[model samples]
Target chain A: MRILIIEDDQVLAAGLKVGLGLAGMTVDLVGSCAQAGEALATTAFDAVVLDLMLPDGSGLDVLRGMRQRKDRTPVLLLTALDEVADRVKGLDLGADDYCGKPFDLDELAARVRAIGRRGGGRAAPCLTAAGIALEPSTLSATLNGQPLALSRREFAVLALLMEHPGAIRSKGEIEDRLYGWGEEVESNAVEVHVHHLRAKLGREKIETVRGLGYRVQVAP
Target chain B: MSSLRRRLFAILVAATGIIWLCGILWIFVGAKAELEHVLDTRLQEAARMVDSLVAQNGPAFAAAASAAATPERYQRQLSCQIWSLDGRLLARSGSAPDVSLSDHAAGFSDRRIQGEYWRVYTIDNPAKGVRVLIGDRLGQRDQLAVDLVKGLSIPAILMLPLLGGLLWLSLGRGLRPLLAMAVELKAREADDMRPLQTQHAPAELLPLAAALNNLFAKVETARRHERDVTAFAAHELRTPLAGLKTHAQIAMAAGDPGVRQEALRHILLSVDRATRLVRQLLTLAKLESGLAAGQSERVCVGDLIEEIGAAAQPSGKDVAVRIDPALRDFTLTANRDSLAIALRNLHENALQHSPEGGAVVWNVTPDGRGIGVEDEGPGMPPEEISQATQRFFRGKRQTPTGCGLGLAIVEAVLREMGGRLVLENREGGQGLRAIAVLPPATSPCP
Candidate 1:
């Protein structure tokens, strides 16, 4: 898989190239927007790592130019500015992901690979963890290769947690995902769902971190 | 002593006095003149009657005068005297005393008799070679003058207070727009930066209100910019610093020594950068927030300098602190946190700019009215001193030490504390000197 990096800082770009290259990807580095444009015209890449600020112009311009040419390649934006408005602008420009500067090289490589896998159409349409597989496309789940019939509420609760594996999804977020807009949720709906999910899947499948929320660790 | 109300009131009172004096003089002079004219005309008619009677029957004129002497007939009306060309007294009116009129036989004359002023007119009868002298007691003339003055003065005296009251009321009404503005200002919160709503303001005061609102708009923009910078710095620094620490931990757990050493070096650089970034962020936040509003405490300048010196000593620089005995005992009312931040920035700048082994001196002394800080470093050139306190500005010689926000923060803190910070060269070109002049405290120094 080939990934293009558009960054102004040579040191950061070189570091990213080495890191992402080590993650089983071919990396092409370009330091300016002009060079990025030239590379995009001559080559087909699975994903592009774009820095928001460039010496020649803004990365938003590059993103817009790509979209104008009907290019659907996933673009991830890297910026030092963490302002809310800037993030909104990058997302509105059709960026696949946004990461701020001084990011973990591992995190960056993972995002790049995810975007690449998503672009390749081989990315998982279903999330499987700890003996349970959730088919997001059909809003269905199977345990041990057998269909596990669940209520609509249980399916929603599991889907939200599966979307962000290893992350502690808060109770409030689970409720929002389970309930429709303006629907008054039962105060203990998430707890009830977690109780049912644990009873159906195993007790150790869903772990709760105190003072935070619930997480489903991706099974090794 | 120079009150606007008092000055206006005095002006009005003086004008009233001048007008009253002029009116009194007019009454006195006009009444006397009119009275003299009437007396002259009456005297002429009396002389004509006496002359005709004496010519028709010379000795019978005395009887005629006597016949007219009835008190009821004249009704306390008139007094008259007649003198001949030979200066002999002629016919006189009813019980006219032997009081002589003036010997001057023509024109009008004023005289005093028995403490009463008289207006006398003398008319010459050339055909008869006789002079008729007519006189009226000055009391009657003075009485008319007094009556005229009383008529003019009564209403004026009665209306003076009313006029003053109206003037005061109108003056206050004229200033109502300013009062309304003051009331609105007093009602606002300290952090409220809303523009003043002055659409209903008086036309003359609208410009002043608009200018004030413009100033507030600028202040609000500046404050928003500072807040954005601080927030951005904090958020941007956090993830990188966290990643650096995590990577260093990962490297330390690795078995390779070269890789571990490189990771440690990277970690230290990242830590240093993070620390510098956090410090700048805090300083910027402190400066932007200003001194805590409504806080006033007695702060000792000398002790503050000592505290800063001790804090700087940990940075391994030999920072010397000097305190003038007079300033050591002096204290000022300020927010302690803000004052300490301002002083620390100055001391830190001095320390950073000095050579490795060179001394950084913090001199807190009375500068006739305030405290001064003197340092021993390659001082900023004269041209660069003015721009030193601008945001992100560094002198040509001092760019490498750190981010150039030190002096800017100092300037902001001083401004919030109601003091001025002045930068100048030390004597003999040793280094830079900064002076902070605080307002004199009310209580005497102990």
Candidate 2:
């Protein structure tokens, strides 16, 4: 799964990135509403973690912007404001879930996975296409009842592709999934991850889109 | 609760009863005097009648009565007698005493005869050489006076129960609104602080209701202020707590020594931030409780300013401190420690807002009535001066380590010293100005 975390506190944000990254989800973080908006326009993320209090503006502004643009990505608001009125207002303004500060990272990850599944129009935290199944909670992948071993980046790439079976993923968008802000990026990192995913999931499962990027074709 | 009702009834009922008893006593006294005067007139007329009969029918009429039934009421109620003016009684009625009733020479007199009080009238007709006396017992007159007063009192006696019933009903009706108000107060929810209803209350109770409502309004404001402060303090503490938790988690999860060391450093920093917040919170509480200042003492402004100038400089760093010469001999009566804290906070604010090379300037007013300080950095906006000293208020720029209680503490201390913390913008709005004005020496208020 791909997720974006928008929080102003650097230490908390760094911890969230590490925790969510270990859960086998590719996480990109931004500190302001404007940066989150720009990242949303440029990349495809399954869910967003929003903090109400931000350095530039309120996190609710980002949620309103996404909803205004008809972006259906699920949003979970994480804030220090635990008042019921604040929670209800955030939910009324198109937030999928609300968590107050001093939150448990594990519980936040569970909620993120739940919202991610709901965003994909699925009932459970498992994405599958043509018998290629990925369990988000355990980060386990299997092909036709046989377990498939994959690296973190390869698992992230496979999870993204399996979320929407026939949709094409641009190389730049895939690169955004594998890296966060202030990180060194290798030019062919996405290609290497896809090459590894194809070897394990079978060659025909992921197809190249020529100059565009890559896609996993649906079986008839 | 019922005392007010009982007091009203008891006082009013006792007053009316007193007035009725006094009226009955007045009537008894007046009737007794009038009855004695009427009986005296009857005695004089009886003496004249006996005198005329003695002139017409002489000694024969003298034997006419031991007492005859012809004029029974007069004969029974009064006694008649005639005397020779010498020392002898010539004619007498049966009811008159056998002895002379009086030793008087004329007119009317009171005499005791045979152990009964008697009212006697004596007429002297020297031409006839005889005296006539008419006498009645004082006991019978006393009895008549008692009967007259008793006859008048029956209606007043019968009216008592009716008056009591009316008084009770009127008093109950008058106090019904108060009872309703009591019930209204009793039925309220524990935290319900809405003003009491007064629209249907009686006019006499309006002031009480209004006073109660005013108290409710003040309490509500206090409750809201307390709630806001609590929430603000919690938020302040939680942010650092969240940071600490995150850093601790990262330290536990790190596999490399460098990463673990970095995480530990962040943890220490979080602890320091939390500690600073808690200490500031305690300082604010001390100032708010009005106990930290203790007692007022003589404060020498010159010595205080010199100490402030020397101590306020940053540790291991040279920060210029300037005090106006006019402040050298200035002295005031105030709480010394409180004054020191206020000055230190102001100096701290000036230092915090001043730029790297900028200096803080402290000066006394030309009139020598106030002390003012200014920072060299950009001043605050005009609109924020009103709320600058409010507790837990941070500007939108969000300065680092701004617990937002520094100015509030200074303001509280100044207020306790019978002074105010005045905030203003510098010339051309370049920097901020804060002034503290002390009470004049001659003023009585502390």
- By TM-score, the best candidate is 2
Docking class of 1: incorrect
For candidate 1, lDDT tens digit of each residue in A1-220?
4678897554355455545544444578887789889989977777899987665567899999999999999999988777898899999989999888768776777787678657755577667777789764344789989899876577767766776678798997776545432457889989999999889887887899887999986774
Model 1 segments more than 4 A misplaced: A1-131, A134-220, B1-14, B34-77, B83-90, B123-131, B193-265, B272-446
Q: What is candidate 2's local distance difference test score?
A: 0.79
Across B1-446, the per-residue lDDT of candidate 1 in tens digits comes to 68656676678777877988897788778876886677567655654555565556655545544443335533544456666778777777764555666666676787776676666666676766666555666676567667777887888889888888887777677777788898999999988989888878988788988998999999998898786456434434543454474455546454557656656665666566667767776777766775244476887777877777776646565555566666567677777787887888888777776666666555444445657777777787898787677665544565333455777778888777667789988878888788876655522255
Q: Which 10-residue window of candidate 1 chain B scores lowest in summed lDDT?
A: B67-76
lDDT, model 1, position B98 = 55
Pairs that clash in candidate 2: none
TM-score of 1: 0.45
Query: TM-score for all predictions?
Result: 0.45, 0.69
True-structure RMSD, every candidate: 16.6, 7.0
Prediction-by-prediction clash tally? 1, 0
